[model samples]
Target: MPESGSVELVWLFGPFAVYLVMLGVYYVWEGKREEQLRQRYEEAEHGQ
Candidate 1:
């Protein structure tokens, strides 16, 4: 690890942080799309 006052930590963690953010956005979007499709077909929550 570099010194506290150095910029190495940002370089190391930046890409990982960006990846996590993108992953979260994708999951949320996919979930919403799935819900819309399920509702369009009138599917029950528990298959009842």
Candidate 2:
């Protein structure tokens, strides 16, 4: 029931929106993982 112009808009921008969300999720996940690794490394280095 939508117009033809709007359909094109969705095709063009929908992937972009999804990509941005995925990029944000990846950034946050990597940040947390890196933090955990850094903490583990520091603990081991200073414990010796």
Candidate 3:
């Protein structure tokens, strides 16, 4: 069996690692969405 400390470390970091990955993805998605909206607004204004 593995040592007690090793198992504890995995359990602690596993969820944290997943959370960081998800946060990064969310941040990138929001940035792209915001950029798209800005471009559309600019196009509409210039067209008017």
Candidate 4:
């Protein structure tokens, strides 16, 4: 059987790692979309 400390460590760190990964992906996706929107707005303003 696994020790309680090891089990607790796994549970704690596992979710944290997953959350960090998800946050990173979200940030990248949001940044790209924002940049695209800004470019489109700029182009529209310039009548391009």
Candidate 5:
């Protein structure tokens, strides 16, 4: 019974940990994308 509980706990938190990692990756990707867009916009404005 204790082994079963331990396995269940790991199963539950394992997916949660994966989700947190994905969220962190997504957050970083978004920040980088925004920075790139801002730079492009500035370059376009300066070229005109």
Candidate 6:
């Protein structure tokens, strides 16, 4: 019974941990993409 309980706990927490990690990665990627877009816009405006 104790072993089964431990396995269940691991199953629940494992996905939660993976989700948090992926969320952090997504946020960083989005921030970098936005920065690149902003720089391109600024360059375009100056070229005009």
Clashing pairs in 1: none
lDDT of 3 at 26: 100
Displacement of the residue 18 alpha carbon in candidate 2, Å:
0.5
Output the lDDT of residue 34, model 4.
100
lDDT of each: 0.88, 1.00, 0.99, 0.98, 0.97, 0.97
Per residue, candidate 1 scores C-alpha lDDT tens digits across 1-48 of: 668756777888989999999999999999999999989677665566
Residues 1-48, candidate 6: write the lDDT tens digits. 579989999999999999999999999999999999999999999999
The candidate with the higher TM-score, 3 or 4, is 3
Q: Candidate 5, residues 1-48: lDDT per residue as tens digits?
A: 578989999999999999999999999999999999999999999999
TM-score for candidate 1? 0.71
Clash count of each predicted structure: 0, 0, 0, 0, 0, 0
Sort every candidate by TM-score, greatest first: 2, 3, 6, 5, 4, 1
Error of 1 at 43 (Å): 7.2
**Judged by lDDT relative to the true structure, which candidate is superior, 1 or 2?**
2
Query: In model 1, which runs have C-alpha deviations exceeding 4 angstroms?
Result: 1-5, 43-48
Error of 6 at 28 (Å): 0.4
Model 5: lDDT to the true structure: 0.97
lDDT, residue 37, model 2:
100
lDDT of 1 at 22: 100
Summing lDDT over every window of 10 consecutive residues in candidate 1, give the lowest-scoring window: 39-48
- lDDT per residue, candidate 2, 1-48, as tens digits? 999999999999999999999999999999999999999999999999
Error of 4 at 2 (Å): 5.7
